[model samples]
Target: VYNISKEDGANICQWEYWGGNGQKFILEPVKEIEGDVNADGALSVIDVILLQKWLLAVPDAELTDWKAADLCEDNIINVFDLHLLKRMLLEQ
Candidate 1:
């Protein structure tokens, strides 16, 4: 599953795609669009907060793609990442 669907959690599980000819295509694992942590189809301050909460374990917070959250590309998500994300938001 390369492209995630709009339905919440729709792309976050195994799926079976049925073809018109009665063919079945099975895909494993969840597919998350990069930078769409909340999966709302856009990067926003909410995403930043979600990452923050996830790092702090503030309950019910989550990050679907650590790769996307690692803004600095340092293989870690920390306050530094938050700063980078903020900077990116500002630049955009």
Candidate 2:
């Protein structure tokens, strides 16, 4: 299990890997934002805006991994993230 954060520079937030036991790995939920695309601690239009900018070539910090934005697990954050965000907004 993993927790995603939206605060700037927040890394990993929390991650629990399988321990080889029957117990499921659990991580503390991120109360600030759920499904923050850019992990900036809030699920707002800003997250979608940032993702658009990043897709358009805004360079991320050297240590930032692109996987953080790959919301659909498609190995890229493009139209997939956009669609996902749209769906989320509709649900909200």
TM-score of each: 0.59, 0.48
| TM-score of decoy 2 | 0.48
| Per-prediction tally of clashes | 0, 5
- By TM-score, how accurate is candidate 1? 0.59
Where is model 2 more than 4 Å wrong at Cα?
Answer: 1-34, 59-68
**Candidate 1 per-residue lDDT over residues 38-60, each given as its tens digit:** 76767888888888898888987
* Highest TM-score against the true fold, candidate: 1
- 26-86 per-residue lDDT for model 2 (tens digits): 4587553444755666567766666677667777622133455566877766778767876
Q: Scored by CA lDDT, what does every candidate get?
A: 0.70, 0.58
